[model samples]
Target: MAKAKSLKAGDKVEWETSQGKTTGTVKKKLTSPTKIKSHKVAATKENPEYLVETEKSKKLAAHKPDALKKK
Candidate 1:
């Protein structure tokens, strides 16, 4: 399999949603379990998730690194 994308904060990325694909900039890299809004984010140091702000709505959401494609 190909290597997973290494994303960092401020990186422009895109991910798929129910509406379609959306673009965003990475706000932070979650390296530990944390809560955002009411959702429990189960991120870890080895396997991390990104907090991103959507381009259109500017809403924050957590996404797996694999789910994001660098732009």
Candidate 2:
């Protein structure tokens, strides 16, 4: 299995997209239930999620640590 990435705010990361891979910067770590982009996120301290902003579009999205690769 692939190792889980330890990401932090301001860290550069990349994830898969329909167009291909997109790069972004981590905005924050979500450790509690919250809503993002009108979608409900079920993140917890033990299973946290990350909020990232795309470099090109500057769009915000949430993703799991395993889904992100440090750039």
Candidate 1 lDDT by residue in tens digits, 2-71: 2226777898888889999999999999999999899999999998999999999999999998888888
Candidate 2 lands at a TM-score of 0.90
RMSD of each: 2.5, 2.3
lDDT by residue (1-71, candidate 2, tens digit) is 23337788998888888999999999999999999878999999999999999999999998999888887
**Which 10 successive residues of model 1 have the least lDDT summed?**
1-10
Candidate lDDT (C-alpha), each: 0.88, 0.89
Model 1 scores what on Cα lDDT?
Answer: 0.88
Error of 1 at 65 (Å): 0.6
Ten-residue region with minimum lDDT total, candidate 2 = 1-10
Clashing pairs in 2: none
